[model samples]
Target: MEVVRIGIIGLGNMGSAHAKYLIENKVKGAVLAAVCDARTERLEWAAREFGNGVARFAGIEEMYASGTIDGVIICTPHYGHPAEAVAAFKHGLHVLTEKPAGVYTKQVREMNEAAAAAGKVFGIMYNQRTQPLYKKLRDLIRQGELGEIRRINWIITLWYRSQSYYDSGGWRATWAGEGGGVLINQSPHQLDLWQWVTGMMPKRLRAFCAFGKHRDIEVENEVTAYAEYENGATGVFITSACETPGTNRLEVVGDLGRMVIENDKLTFYRLRQSETEFNRTYKGGFGEPEVWKIDIPVEGQRGQHHLITQDWVNGILHGTPLIAPGEEGLKGLTLSNAMLLSAWTDEWAELPLDEDRFYGLLRQKIEASGAAKTTEEKTLDTTGSY
Candidate 1:
């Protein structure tokens, strides 16, 4: 009970990274006890890396039944996340899954339900939540410093993947294997943070998703989604392939003022008076509220993947709250799903999405996918990409 023995499922790019971090003793109160991967080559790599001290399994079931690990970190594909986490929960093991939760909300909902029923620590790898700047942004909104939000715009096109990147894996960009493109893979963190920091969910959304716009993939590579919040606030989410030097910028405007986070800097333009009140009372037709541009100080080190793992381990052993609870993952997935649905149906998709319709359409894509295409397996050093 002192040290939580952790097993990593799927020794792919992300799984191997987690394994290396644990092997290096980066996370306190956590030890790398086991690993699982269907690929024999990956299993051989694990054996070579960790030697005989770490147990190797062919799959999740074998690893779970081995009973060597107190927790499992599911880093499998988009589809495998929910099922593997649910199985881990059923076997009474804590789970810390990588982001997006799963391809869709239904399966993720089922996994969350099982985690709740099991009464075990369930966390998602929303590592960005550990960033001090985002934490401060969420706090500012929650504390009503920005007043009622009016608009949210995030231009996050930093996810530039090449054709070879998609070709490297059979499941890379295919709907049946990886679910969707940019929205599901590269944008999960931003999607989660968008709703997380704003403290608001869209009531409806319309999206224009360009499938294979930049890459030769089946899923969307470029997307422009317009969302309407319940409180009349609107949002625009724009993302694309690595066509140019990408940009990551987020701007939130409210009654009191506006806040922007870009280039690791948080700036706030505080209005002397509420914009709404000024508009209502001002006698001048064109005058607006006076504004003060202030740079909000975010002074702290930003924790990434390893810190999230540490927190997950801490949550299990010390009852510390998780940075990203598994249940909250559904919110971001909902937005992704809604955007895809809107693009497919050519209409504004509403909240509490039609799960059945989405599932049916997804199944159709899977069936039509026919044979999976794969290229040379390449694992890049994902340093600042996270």
Candidate 2:
């Protein structure tokens, strides 16, 4: 197909935004051909806003049956992600899922298997990976400019959601609905970028998660996690609600230097020699390796969701490499799931996480969540939040 006809499921805040972008001709080589939502009001909105050119369906199956779209973008809730993607793949359609893959790894694994078997292009909306600063960081590490990584720390607590925000949706912050709180809803991109930029996944992790710590919700709002990589390097991740003025800072320490990203600025502290070699050869007992503080330049605009969507279309039509492959999304989901699992069990969770156990525990939570209580709905302007 020269141009990809894209259908978006779940016409909520994000789904609506995607529709508007496409209708406004924001993404090149892509058109909003179809849309699906169980809610009649949402379908009406789509019809009114997008006009008669866009086909509207009550469910994903009907949308697929219509055969109006060459690809599908799943923007449903946390749980519907995997199921919808698998359905799209079964119909031999390309898919681009939002993030977190799904509520749990077991289901996401099945979805990935289906995508692999279908041989269709599967992409995940890890939009932050398109940021120039993160791309630069990944390049620096991959080029061995930072030498051996020794430590990493990220304080990404800018995801402050009020109780009203949670109350706006029935599935805002529930174990059964949205999976977890901050980690699942707000920090998925950061968690994905953590592994994406570093190119490392923790071998094991211990996390302390506080449920309803800031809001009247059932999932985590505050978390402090410690991770140990296979290379013996350690890292710490701290995230929370709007407890204080949130901070977004990432620091990576290596034997030769350290890189810090904060306030939209990138700084590097380079050592004249590797700390390991200096320590081994220096005669002085108290001297340290000479350090130079240099400002790293990162250029270009951050290609957020729109960029990923365009790339997904490009990948399907022209064999372009996806910025976020659906298969690799499991790594970040594993980290998030491991954190919740560790907090729930009060123990460290190992990598290649116990899928069955996690799924079982999640099922229990779903059963226990009696009925979701929703308040007056409001879609906050999510312009600068990302």
Clashing pairs in 2: none
Tell me each candidate's TM-score.
0.94, 0.95
For candidate 2, give the lDDT. Answer: 0.85
**Each prediction's Cα lDDT score?**
0.87, 0.85
RMSD of each: 4.1, 4.1
Model 2, residue 180: C-alpha shift (Å): 1.1
Error in Å for residue 52 of model 2? 0.6
lDDT tens digits, residues 245-344, model 2? 8999999999989999999988999999999999899997889999999999999878568989988888988998888899988988999999999999
| Model 1's TM-score against the true structure | 0.94
- Position 242, candidate 1: lDDT: 54
